[model samples]
Every structure is written in C-alpha cells, then in structure tokens.
Target: NTLDYDYTNEEYDLIYNPLKMQGKKEVEVEVWDYNKVGKNDIIGVVNIDILPSKNKETQIELFIQPKNDKGEVQSNLNTDQKLGKISFSMIYIPEDDYLKRLRDAELKKRKTEQELIRQKELEEQRRLDEIKRIADEQRRLEEEKRRQQEALNAQYIKGYVQFKNISVSNLKKMDFIGKSDPFVLFKAGESSQQTTVAKNVLDYQYLNEEYEVLYDPSVMQGKHEIEVEVYDQDSVTKNDIIGAVSVDILPSLNQERQFDLFLQPQKDKKDDSSKSETSSTNSDKKLGKVSFSMNYISEQDWIKNFKQEQLRKQKIKDEIIKQKELEEQKIKDEIQRRLDEQKRIEEEKRKQKEALDAQYIKGVVQFKNISVSNLKKMDLIGKNDPFVLFKAGELTKQTTTAKNTLNYDYLNESYELLYDPAVMQGKHEIEVEVYDQDSLTKNDLIGAVNVDV
Candidate 1:
C-alpha cells in the first residue's frame, strides 16, 4: 500500500540491506514519505535507474520530487513544511554474480592456503644439526678432522662427484655412419633433473664432468647412489640406449673414493649378422664399464656459521622493518592528533560564533523619536492609550519605560537608555514594544519592532 510512518528521534538510523534486484539490469526503486497529521500525504518519490559496466565502475544520480494527492508535484523547501531530502543512488548488481563473487573469494582463500602449505613444508624439512647424534658427534668429528687435513690442499671443500668414463654394451652402429655418437648421462636423487652429462668424451676422455652436491651431513649418513646411462645418438632414428650404470655416492666427507661402475644393456636389440668384424666383439660390447669417483669435504662448521650469519642479517632486517612499521604508526597517530585538535578548535569557534551577537559593546542608546501607530482601540470609548518600553539584547535587560503619551499617540520623547558596553558587544537589536496602560488590567503587548542599533 502506502508507507506512512512519522520519523521520530527514537529511530534515527535508516539502513537498507542488500536489495537483491534479481538478474534485471534496469530496475526502478521508489522512495515515498506519507506522514501527515490526520491523513497520508505523498511527500516525494524518486525512480532509481541502474547503470552497470563490466570494465569500469560507475555511479548514478536521481532527483526526488515532492508530490501531493492527484499526482501533482509540489516544492516545500522554503516553507515550514520540512519534508527532508534523501540522497538515493542505488548500484544494482545483478544476482547472477553471486557464484562469480563466491568463486573469486574461494580462489583468494585457496591461494592463501597454498602459500601457507609451502611455508609449512619448508619448515618441516629435516635440519642437519637437529639430526646430528650427540653420542657419535665426537668420534665423527675426530675422524672427519683426519680427512680434512688430507683434503686441505683443495681447501675447505663441501663435496664433489666425478664422472670418469662409460663402457658400452649391445651397441649398434647406427645407420651409414659406421660410428656411434655416444655419450653418458648420470644424475643423483629421484628427480630426472640434476643429471650431470659427460662432455668431450666422444673418444676416451673419461672423467669429463663433476657435480658439487650440498648435503646435510648430520641428517644424511646412508649411501646415495649415482645413476648413469650410455646412449647411442643416431642422426635419423630415436637415440638407442647402449646401457645404464648405478654408482654409489661416496661416504667420506673429506677424502675422495674411486670406483668403477659396470654398465648393462637397457633393452635387447637384434644381432646384426652382416657386421662380422663387430660380431666377434658384440659379446664383449653388450657388457660395459663406467669409471667414476665421488669426494666429500667436512666443512659443516663453515656452512653452519655462514648460515647463522645470514640468519642474523635477516633478523636485523626484520627488526628494521618492525621499527619502520612502528614509526609509521606513530606518524599516523600524530597526524590524527593534529586533525582532532583542528576539529576541536573549529567546534569551539562554531559554538562561540553561533549568533551574530556582540561579546562587548559601548555606545550611547537614546530613543530620539518614538511613534506608535495602528493602536488597538481601548478604554471602551473607541480611544486608545499607548506607551513604549525599550530594551537591549542582554541578560540584565537594558530596559527603559517611557512615560505615557496620554490619549492615543505619544509626543516626541527622548529617553537615554543607560547601556553597559563592558558586558556585551556586536549587533544588538533595540526592541521597542508598545503597551496600553491599564491600571485594572495587565499591560498588553500590541506589537513590537526589532530595531537595529
């Protein structure tokens, strides 16, 4: 029907929750006021149009019109009728975006969760010092010291793995080349990456590549194996795997250990009968050998100390960042304090300047000429008697009563109103009110003029 409720001081808050406008892009929202004393009256109504864009955000404005019954428009701003205005701007988002917004929020939450998961994983990794056994530490250190002296010439080494050479097996001479383009591939760990391949070993330049591995000593003590494979690269066909080799990672942390890794055929290939020269060697060719050496240097103390230094630097940086944040917070607090002080001063000035009245005024207030017109007929004889009392704008009331100008009008009277300028200043209105002298009845205020002094 019609909305009609008087706005009271008890209920000042007006909040409109999400007005789900469905999937419609264009909708009209109307606001009406129907609070009259005895009946309902249409104060105003406005139609809101929703304008939405995907790439850019926008805003819209609608004007409200005050209307009375019979759909006629009216304006009441200048009159006593105070049907206050309402600023209505509705950004109608379609309900179809509910899932989109939910998905976006979910995506953000998942990303945050993923980052936290990675951080937890890094923290969970086993540390060397944490796993180092206290009982065996002394013996391990003593034994590592002896190896350190032996490796001192290389000087403060971490660890190094050397790949020497590879012997092939069941190798087929690829195509018309009559020579196999052969190379060896080797790596450590589970991931296929980190494989150190041999260079310059087309003939017999063994021990071509070296890989320096950083391992946690106190955490890792078991033998880690190095996997090696030999490949025959053909120009036209897919590369043929000659064989594969598995070599154990060296155990010593200081002195290097040398060993020979035997290679075996990865897959059985058809025997070539025409190559009678290689047929005799085919049996020996199928089985091959790979020579390699792995070395380790016990420098856990140096690595540990360097890591500690880096951690100290990071701690210092974190402290600096924290201090910067605190300083920024302090600056923000200071700015807010200044703003609050400014607001307080402005409020004080507003209270003091509420009225255009004077704080102190000094001047002679003398009623030079006095006249009373349009006097109400009194005394029952159609005759009137009127006199005037002059007062200034003050609490004590700078007042002066003039003698009755008997009959209907007053003679030109000059009365000096003693005004204390030490108490008041600024504009003071001289109020001249006319009163009829009635000994039996109280004095009647017929009219008054707020005169400027």
Candidate 2:
C-alpha cells in the first residue's frame, strides 16, 4: 500500500494503517519529488526497523540515497548525500489494551470540559458581583442627593401669615326661615380655621377672631392659596356652602392687608348630575363677600433687619469712641511737645549764662608744649598712654592722650581761673597731675605738682 499527499510546511502529522507483520519488522520509506510531466524523481530512501515492544517511542531518520529493486543502496549514486528527515511512531496493542486507551482518552476529555465549565461559572459570578457593586454605589449617591435637597428646603421656609378681624357680609339665603346663620372658614394648604356662627343675620362680624399660619415660601411658590368659605348652619342637614373665594397667597401678601373677597357660587349637585359641564353664566353667579386683614412677615427678614440695625448703632458708637480717643491722644501729644520745647529753651539759657560767666575769668593757665617724659607702663606690654590734668579751685581740664608713648606734649591747651573777690581775692595755687590712661580701669596717677597763679 502507498500513501501520498502534498504538504506545504515543516511540521505535519500522518497516520497509517496497521502493518500486517507482528513482533519486529523493517519498513522502507522513500522520498520523491513529484513532476506533472512524467514519472516522479527519487530524492532519497531509508529502511527503518520497527519493534513492537518499544511502540510508544517514535523513530527519526535522515534520508540517504535511494535503493534499487534488490533492496540494496544504489552504488552508482553518492550514498552519503544529505536529504530531508522524517519521524514516525508505530504502536501495536491487543484488543483489551486498545479499549482501555480509548476509555482513558474519554475520561481526560470529560475532565477538561468540567474544568472549562467551572472557569466560566467563576467569571459569571465575578461579573454579577461587579454589577451589584455599581448598583449599590448609585443608590448611595442618590440617597445622599435626597438628603442634601431636604436640608436645603429646610432653610427655604420663611415665616407665617396672620389673619385677623374676619367677617362676612350679604350672604345668600339658603333656608326658608329668617336670615341664614353664617360663619366664615379660612383654609390655607393643609391648615384650616373657622369663626363662631352669627345666627339669623345677613351681615355677620366675628368677635375675637385671629388665625396665625406658618408659611414656607419654598413649597408655596405658585400653588399656595387661601380659600375663604361661608357656611350656613342647619340642624337637620349638611351645612350649606353659601359661597367660596380663593386668593393666591403670594400676590395677596404683597397687597394691602385688608381683603374684600367677593365670593363665587358653589356648584349645584343637581345641575352637575343632569349635565356634563356647567355653563359659564351659571358658574359666574355671585355670592356674599368675606372681609379680613391678612398680614405676612418673614421672621428671617425681621431677624436680619434687627441685626443690621444693631450693627449700625454699634458702628456709630465705635466711631464716637475712636474720635474721643484721637482727641485725647492729640492733646497729650501737644502737651509733651510743649514740655520738650520748654526743656530745650532752659538748656539754651543755661548754656548762655555759662558763656557770659566765662568771659569774666580773673586768670588763665596757658598750656603749650607741655610734655611728660618716662612715664611708668600701666599695661602688660606697651608704653604708657600719658595725659596731664590741670585744676585751679573748682575747675579742671584734661589734655589729649599721647597713645602708647612714654613722652606726651600738650601742644595746644588752655584753662581759665575765676577770680571771685569773695572767694579767691589773689594768688590761687594750680594743681598739675600726670597720669597713664587705662580704659579698662581708673587712670594711673604718676606725679602731681602745685603752681602759684
């Protein structure tokens, strides 16, 4: 038997029918180049020995030169010429072993299928968990938004409306007897208040009637209304609605406090049963009128206005205090400046008096080229810095320092001696002292002398 095919790639798997021989046998494999024009050319051929005992192992062989019909390598061709390679496996199994191998393969396939299904289930569960997480997050966000709106609306509630001195006039006659007993009812939103009945009168005035209603303008923007209904009292039947008037709250709040509401007639139940709609003429029938004083004041506005007034008063008070402080500081500064000027004037006058008295000195001690030689050292390692001091009565004068020199000469210096006839009438003794200057301590006195002036 021969198997032939065309393959385009490097790797391929081929299956062949079982060989007829058992145990061990040799199989010859041939490689050929196909030609469409004539017989195919023989590329190479190889003989491979098959052992049934090692059936699980595959044999790989490199092809050599082709063999002749005698089953011997061709001597005419170059036998070692390199060609392509081939690999194949041959297994021989009895009937029982073959059936066992098939069962094992089936079990492996089922295990692989079960593993794929488990992975799919895990993926689905993870997807569902992600969806639940997203849903929970959205709900939390919406709940937070709702709470924020609720908080905002709480601040939007403003204040209240007060209705006082309620009365009604010229109510319709509903009964067969005398003037109908009439009362007034005021309703706003979910709240209602009524007045005592004034029996047997066409006109009625309610005594000590007052109603205060809480107002939240955020919820009352366009829909809020006040309904004033006049009802006539009857002992045996339902109270008759003489008329009713509805006034929009926001506009009425802006208008004058006194309201004269002309009522509109109630719908007749008998007429409503017989017809689908009432005519405009019948619906426009006039009833009585209700009179009341309505007042609305926002507590938020009142508190804000009160705070502004307090702030204005406090600002005025602070301004007055600041002005007073500024005035007092200004006066204190003026007084200090005057005191400083007085001290400066006194100093100048004293200096002038000293100059005038110095002009009258009776005697003068003149110093020129007054030198000192060989003064003792006052420091650890330098020549003495020397100076001379002259004193006559209460006056003293000092010469300039000679600066690290043993000899110092007072080149230009003078001293005046006052001759008070009461104290020093004549010759005064002048004291001359030579000293070494030490900045860190007292001056070191070296010598002294008295000179008669």
Candidate 3:
C-alpha cells in the first residue's frame, strides 16, 4: 500500500524485514508523483545494501538517481537531479532478541493499565467514606439539637394543676361478706399517685386528700391525659380491679376544670362472670362514678400574687402592732401576746414539715453473697460469663461477672437500693435477673427471680 501526504516536511518510523538473509541483501527506495491522467510519473529511486556484519544502527542521506521507463539507470545524462532531500535510520535486529523485546514491551503495557485501575478504585473508596462521614456528622447534630430542646422544655414549668375535692361513689362490691374497700390510682404517663384506701363503703369522700400535678415536658409532656383506676383491697389474694376511667387534662391548663367521669368495668370481668355460678345482672352497666375538680395555677402569676399577699399581710400585722403600742397595754400582756404568736408560728412549721415528710418512706435494702447455678451455656469455647442484676422500683444494681464457670458465686457482691413505699404501693419485690455477657452483642438473659422485700 502507498501512503499519500500533502505537506512540505514529514517524518515516519518504518520497520523492515531481513527476509532470512545470511550474508548480504539489497533494498531499493522509490518516489512517485500521483496523476489523474493515464500513466503515473516516476520521481526518483535509490538503491542500498545491507550486510550481516554491519553496525546496529545506520544513517543515510537520499541521493536521487534518474531511471528510464524500463527501470534501467541512465548513466549518460548527468544533470543535478533533486526534488527534496530525506534522511532515515536503519537498525538490524536478530529473531531471538526481537521476540524478547516484544514480550517485555507487552508486560510494561499491562502493568501501566493495572496501576491506573488501582488508582481509580482507591479514589472511589475515598469518595464513599467521605459521604458516610458527612451523613454521620449530620445525624449527630440533629440528635444534639433534639436533646437541647428537650432539656429546655424540662427546665421551664408551664403551670400547675391542683386536683382537689376528689370522690368516688357506687363502686361494685368485690367481697361476698361486706362492701369493697376501695382506693383510687391516678396515673399520668409513666408516673402514678394514689389516694389512701377507703374502708368498707359504697361511697367515699376524700376530704383532705389532694394531688398537685406539675406541667413539664419531662414528666407528662404538656397536659397529657390522666388514667384513674379503682381497686378493692384484699388481705390474701391479689386486689380486684373495679373500674377505670381516663380524664382529659387540657382543660385544666386554661381554667379550673371539673370532671364527672363514669367508670367502666374491667375488661375481663364479663368473661369471668360467665364462668361463675351467680353472675350479677348489672355486669354490663357502668361500674361507678368519680367526681374531681382541677384548679390551674399559672406559675408566674401565682408567684407574683403570693408575694403581693405576703406584703399585704405584713402591712396589716404592722398596723395591728402600732395600734397595740398606742393603746398603752401592759408590758406583761405584750410579752404574753408575743409569746403566743411565736408558738403559733412554731406549730405552723411543725405541721408543714410533717406534711412534707409523709410523701416518702425511705428504706435501705442490702444484697450480699449472690450466686447462680445451672446457667445455660452461651459460648462454644468456654463456660458462661454470668452476672446478676437486682432491680427494685426505679433503682438497679448489678454483681460482677464470673467467668468460665457453671456454678459461679459472686461472693461479697453486696448492693443497696433506696425504695419509697408510698410511690411503689404494693409492688415492693426485687427482681433478680441473670445474664451472660457477650463482647460482640447485647447480653443474653439466662433466668429471672423475684424476691419480696
């Protein structure tokens, strides 16, 4: 094939075959002027010779020789014939060396391609890691913001609700011999407060009993509903659930709210009565009714009003003292009056302290020498790593983990928990839970037991 070009200067690298020559060989070069007419015109030709004993590389200059149409060199005519000069280099290579060089070049090409692929993979991995880091940071920021808002809401007290004048009437009788001894359980969210039991009566009035409900996001999440349950007190068996009712607390936030809720019977009562011999006729009717009043106390306004009232009382007391001084009363009488006033103040303080002290009964409970036997095997390589957790009400404590033993004893593992009887009611049992510790995941529970305190 012929290569055509339309430029004044050009360069090209060419490879030539030795054609299995042993001693010497001859090579010819030709140039031609392409034409669109009939026959093509020859520009010039050069003849070269190659020998086996020549150098590896050689440079040559083009000296055009004129030739006839039959391809014979014309030595008779000697006019300096030249179009453009060209120079080239020629290298001689043997068969074995040529094959080795070809293989090395191929190997280098593959290594370069593999290196580029590795760099691209590393770049992609870095980009993915950066994306994951950004996502994690954003999640952390959102969690922090939520926690801060929750803290702010908990610190601010919106208002208070005074639940007073509480009473329940016409409760269902749980006992065969006498009327039921009933009590009211008031629960808001996870926290609960109850009134003292009323002994053996169909209707009961809580004269001096009152519950103060504070509005805070941490406790009740801003005016959530309150759940009321009535139960009959029993000596032996579990207490019987009489009825339940839910009271809305939103109205108490605006003004003094009054509630007259009719209690509904327990859900499983009808099913139990169906199995009983003497089923009452009023089983499907309303259980009873509860009447209560709630007075909303705005924290800011109540504080301001209380200070004003205190100032007014102080002024009145001052006026009275001035009038007593102007009357020219006896000195002994004045001393006696002052003594009586001091006694009144002391009595008031005593009553207030007693009222506060009645809220909780603090008690200390100690656990010691805890052990567990026959724990389930959780690990394939060794015995279970077991620990004991003691939970009483809202308090919890745990024993140290004993490693690689079936009959493990946590000797001298003692703990203490403070319990409030009023808040916990009759749920005074300590829950003992056994667990197997794991390094890669959550601890597995083995067994549990409850001990009554």
Candidate 4:
C-alpha cells in the first residue's frame, strides 16, 4: 500500500505504506523516497514499526516527477517542500535600553556642543576683554602723558620786561643784565641825533666792557680816527676794532674872539695914528685882517645858532613831559573806574546774600506749624518777623475750608499749605489754601478725616 501527503499552505502532509519496503523484521517497514523535491513537492525517507511498539513511527514525503514517458517517480526531486517539521521561536526586545543609550549619546553630543560653544564664547569674551583693557590702559597712559605735557607747558615762563631812564649814561653796566638793547641820544652843537648804541649788550660783556670810542665826546670833537671794540662773555678782546669814527673839531671861541677885535677900525686919525704905532709893535702876531674878520662873523653866527637850538630843545622837552603826564592821568582814571565797578559789584552781592538769608529764614518758619496766614495778614512775610506759637490743641478742630483748589499751574509764584496727618492726629480733616502774589486768597478746600495717620 502507498500513502501520499502534501504540505503546501502552512499544512503538513504524510505518506505511508510505500510499495517498496526494505527492513529486517516484519514489523519494521522502510520507505523509499526521492532525495530532491520539485516545486511544492516533498522528498525524504523514513522507517516505521506497525506492531510491537512500531520503531518510532516514521513518515516520508516525496517530491518527484515522472522519469519516463510512462510517468514513473524520479529519484531526484525539484521542489521547495521538505518532509521535516519547521519550528520558530520569537524573542522580545525592550526599546528602553536602546532608546536610553541613544538618548545618552545624543545628550552627550549636545553637552559637548554646548561646552564647545561655551568655551568659544568665553574665549571671545576674553579676547574682547583683553582688547578693552589694553585700550583703556593706553587711553589712561595717553591721558597721563598729555596731562604731564600740559603741566610742563604750564611750567615754562612767558612774560615781558620794560625799563626806562633819563639817559643811557645814567644806566650802569650791571643794569643791562635783563635789558634787551639801549638807545643813545647825542646833542652835538644844535643838532640832536638818536642812535641805537648797542644791541644785546648783555651778550657781549667781555672784551668791549668800555664805551665805544664813537660815543666819546672828546674823540667826536677832534680830527682823529676812533675805533670801537666788541667783546664776548669771557671778557676776551674779540674784535678790537669793529667800527671806526672820524671827527673834526672847529676853532676855539677864544681864538675867534681875539681875531674879531683886531679887525675893528679906529674912530679918530690921532687915535688911529697911536693905534697904528701899537699895531706895528704887535706885527709879529699871527692875525691877518681878512682872517680876523672871517673869524669874528663866524663867532657871531655860532652864538645865534646855539641860542635857537637851546630854545628848540626846551620846546621838545616840554612836549615829551606833557605827553607823559597825559598818559599817567589816563592810567589813574582807568584804575579808579575799575575800583568803582568792583565796589558796585560787591554791594550787589551783599544785597543778594541778604535776600537769600531772608528766604532761608522764611523757609524755616514753615516747619514749626506757625500760622502763615496770621503772618501774611500782618504784612510781615519778608520782615524777619518773630515766631508765633499756638496752644497745644486750641485750634485743632476749627475745620478750615478752602475754595477752588491748589494746582501746579502757578508753581513758580504760588504758595500752598500742606497737611501732615501724622501731626494732625485725631483731627477730623485738614485743608489747604492758595494765595496770589498780592496776598489775595485764591483757593480753599473742605476738611475730611479720610487721611491715614
């Protein structure tokens, strides 16, 4: 007998009692099956015992095809089916562990990124802080240097010096210590000339300590060559003849006088004869008629010219003195004007101070709860009036009232009374009134006990 089974759609098939059996015992049956299976066919071999506790019941399924044209079973099968049972077991996995690990990794990555970001920010901040610190320090140093420079500049001195004297001759050598240069005036005959005698005399005080020869009146009056010297600070004779001066002196007045008398003629012939005899006796004298007359006229002209020059000099002196007096008077007037202006300013300041003091005194009175209205009624607002005291609780509940109200509109010139519930304890209400600059009452309000103590 032959049994066939098919296992195709998740089902098992059994084939038993094959026609060709091979076994030693009668009860033990061997089945012959193909080694290979075809599509959806099974191939295998098994042995079984029918009786006496069958030799472990065996089953075989074959997957075969017709080997010949007669349709015989083939030994080789070509199928995806087998005769053995296939068993599968499933394992359960928890997502928490993997999720936790992944979360941890993600958290670590985030932490690292955050740390890197924090470090970068810190580095950037440090760099900025360093730059700012350096800049601030540089600025501080520059400011210090500038301040020091300014101090040094302030330390240097800048000023001017002026000196005046009647004449350069009146000035001593040492007087040129702080002077720049000196101007000299020479009055030769009737003509006066001004000249700058020396420049930077203090710089050349060595070799040329003595006055220049050109400045000497004796040399200027005589016909001779005069040399001037310039020296250095070491007193060494640097240039002994830096400048030269030539001068020619005129005839003396005495000689001119003697020649003038010799030119006069006698008034009578008898007198002339006597004079002629005397003149003959004095013939050896160095006076000639022509020379004597010329001398006489030159002497007369010199006298007239001298007097005119003197008068001119006097006029010039008077003019200089007048100008000096006018300049001095102007300086005095300016000083007096400044003094008067100062005094006026001082008086104004004093008045302002007195006014401020009066205001301060008035402000003090407001703190003492003194009746400002009574003072105002007495017209004693700015009179430095004495303080008035009120009975402890005499007017406590008088309940003053106000009309209109106080406002910030007139803050500049308005006066308003303020109430303190702390001081007006147990009182029903407090009222404030506003008054105008003319002391006329403007606003008042009704009192109430709504204020907190």
Instruction: State every prediction's TM-score relative to the real structure.
Output: 0.23, 0.28, 0.31, 0.18
lDDT of 3 by residue, 253-321 (tens): 647777776677555644422111112322335577777887656677667766988999999999989
Candidate 2 local lDDT, 248-294, one digit each (tens): 45444434477776667664657422211112322434577778887
Error at 46, model 1, angstroms: 99
* Candidate rank order under TM-score: 3, 2, 1, 4
- Model 4, poorest ten-residue lDDT window? 287-296
Highest lDDT among the candidates is held by which one?
3
* RMSD in Å for all candidates: 60.5, 40.0, 44.5, 58.4
Off by over 4 Å in 3: 1-157, 221-223, 266-284, 301-453
Q: What lDDT tens digits, residue by residue, belong to model 4 across residues 1-453?
A: 235454355533233333544443222112344445654333332222334323232443333233334433333443533443222221222346446866998999999999999999999999999999999999999999989866744432221111112122212232324533443322222333333345545322112221111222232332111111111122333322111111111222122221211222223435312222123343322211211111111334445755888989988989888988988898899889889988999999889856654433211112222233322232234321222222222233221222222322222222233333334343433333223232365222212223211
Model 1: residue 222 alpha-carbon error in angstroms:
8.1
Residue pairs with backbone atoms closer than 3 Å in model 3 (clashes): none
Q: By the lDDT metric, which is better: model 3 or model 4? A: 3
Please give, for residues 139-253, the per-residue lDDT of candidate 1 as tens digits.
Answer: 7998898687456433423344443333333344443535556666655443232233333233333334454545432333232444566766655778777566544444544
The lDDT values for all models are 0.53, 0.69, 0.72, 0.36
